[model samples]
Target: MRAVRLSVVTATAAVAALTAVTGCTEKSSSGSGDRVVEVTATDDKCEVSKKEFPAGHVELAIENKGSKVTEVYVLFPDDRIVTERENIGPGTKQRVTAEVKAGDYQIACKPGMKGDGIRQNVKATGGTVAKRDPRLDKAVASYRAYVQAQADETLPLAETFAAAVKAGDLEAAKKAYAPSRIGWERTEPVAESFGDIDPKVDVRADGLEDGQEFTGWHRLEKALWQDKKIGAAEKTLADQLIADLKDWQKRVGKAEITPTSMANGAKELLDEVATGKVTGEEERYSHTDLVDFKANVEGAEKSYALLKPVAKENDAALVTELDQQFAALNTLLDKYRADKTSYDFTSYDKVGEADRKELSDGVNALAEPLSKLAAAVVAK
Candidate 1:
């Protein structure tokens, strides 16, 4: 089948609104020492008339006033405290009492539901609540722009990969191949819409470079670039790679798009490369792959960015928990760059089993935090 390219899907306006309106409140109660806050959730979203609260022992009354099943959760900076009420039907209100510290926080609803997820900033001010920060809006905008810019750069990277292969520079080709592969992989979700295309048959394995039979795109590039005699065989190889590229572009344009799907696709493509399974005559490295990888990284960045505002606003006990996960992912990327060959499954032993295990463990460490974050986003 023709390889699929990956692409990112943007969030809708409705989803944005759902997340914007859910506020938190802290108010003086009848008692002398503590405060009481009333939080409500509608089928569509959550609401708190007041957006700020005081840092101290507080009682939060979470009410479900809408018709659908819903939930209300208060996230702490440390991610250590999460209070939730499930299956609160229409007109039902459940009270969850918890001690909240003074700081910034986030109120979330529908933990795993899709569309119009609810999230609101909660600021604590000397036992009083405050308004949302204007700076946060700007930060979100900046992040979105950054991701889109990375997406725009994919096409040029693909072309560079093609050129590197044509030039017969193995070293350059290696670098070029990564970006192109990453682009296609990251765009795979959207590419799926084009359906599957069988690999072209004319791309053969007969060519040799430096007396060695070459396979896969990298091997093909080596032969074409190193071969001194530019003849019919070279032309055939170049034509095949071009055809593959066209096929890839066509498929990637049509599939459903999402950052998670794109990231998964990039991971798969990288796996294929490491395993030496990508085969076909028309294959050439494309710079687009690097763009796709960057896109995936941007997706992770978005998740991280979203958490920062939430952490600062909510004093969620888990702030450090979330930050550590993002840091681990960054470390993984750094290691990958430091030794691309380390990802080669065939050569795992060369990197040492211990190192490989460390990499594996690091990725696993991200699963819970990512799932929690994704759940927060999808829930809305």
Candidate 2:
């Protein structure tokens, strides 16, 4: 469910920043004296206030002056994302906080949220980031284990779904589909960090790149449900799907996991629910969005629960809000399922407009507080 609108350049080219300056001139500091890099994103250019800063927590104060919704990325020289803030609407402002090691990096702004973004070379210089709370380190370790476990579990379920597809048993494939996706949906942010993997394994038809072959779950999904025919091409895709998943499973342990990334990733899951599952764009044919939706919430909750000890110590009120909102959202979701413990739920197509609105509202309410989690967890 990644909206990978941009094609990444090669490692060397991705490190080179475009030389264009039409925005903020000098660097500034927040009232708390943290390094603040002001980013002005236009339709054709991405301007950063300063190209260098001390390594630790840096805040990107971004304003999208473009005519379209934009996305900003803090990327490794190899185009691996460190952290990102997506869907920044025209004329709106957003602030993203990220931790960085001392190294060369690029800040990319994707205007219209497509193609390789305008890039700027930036450097995180020498500075001692404060010693983190030991619990935060433990939280990261626990989350990493959770991510790998999800990846490990998902492959077998996906294999089951693929086996059914290869056999041309539509009913069996349909039965396996929702169960197969639960693990992936739960850890999508970690999975998506691989850059090359998500598009191959999960990309929807509309999210496809130019001339990109449709060969992921959605492609096979269309074959099973929409096209209502499983042929040679679909059989091939089913095998390819398992192959891609295996690649993801092998690479899962190497993903970058940090406290802020986990917090940011938790929020990203809600964004997924809001834009894809809730809108019925994801699982459009199968109407199994509720299953995916539940998984996203569970994933977010897992991260929050791990971080709660630190977050509560830092900002008790925010934790209170998160607890309430999570409970409320989970309760709301329960109404759709007759068997509360199972994945089975009323098909999304059977849900009414009013019910969808309530769901959307629940997500938005939780997302607002959830977005503050990174800052809270990192607070002294």
Q: Write down the TM-score of every candidate.
A: 0.39, 0.95
lDDT, candidate 1, 1-380, per-residue tens:
12211111132433344345544233333343335567677665566646665664344566776767665555443221234334456776654443344676556666233332366666665843333244434544554444344334545665675566566555675556555444444333233323222223111243221233333344454454444333445445544555655665544333333322222232332333221222212233221222233334445545356435544444444456766765775566555344543322222223445654564465446533443432222121
Highest TM-score scorer: 2
Model 2 agreement with the true structure over 1-380: per-residue lDDT tens digits: 85664565576766443444343233443443446788888887787778888898888889998898888988887777788888889999988778888898888888877777878888999866777899999999999999999989999999999999999999999999899999999999888776778888888888887888887899988888899989999999999999999999999889988899999899989989998988999999999999999999999999999999999999999999999999999999999998779889889999999999999999999998998999898887
Displacement of residue 129 (Cα, Å) in model 2 is 3.6
Question: Where does model 1 exceed 4 Å of error?
Answer: 1-151, 168-171, 182-299, 302-319, 332-350
| Candidate 1 Cα deviation (angstroms), residue 79 | 38
Model 1, position 39, has a per-residue lDDT of 68
Model 2: worst 10 consecutive residues (lDDT sum):
20-29
Residue 46 displacement (Å), model 1: 35
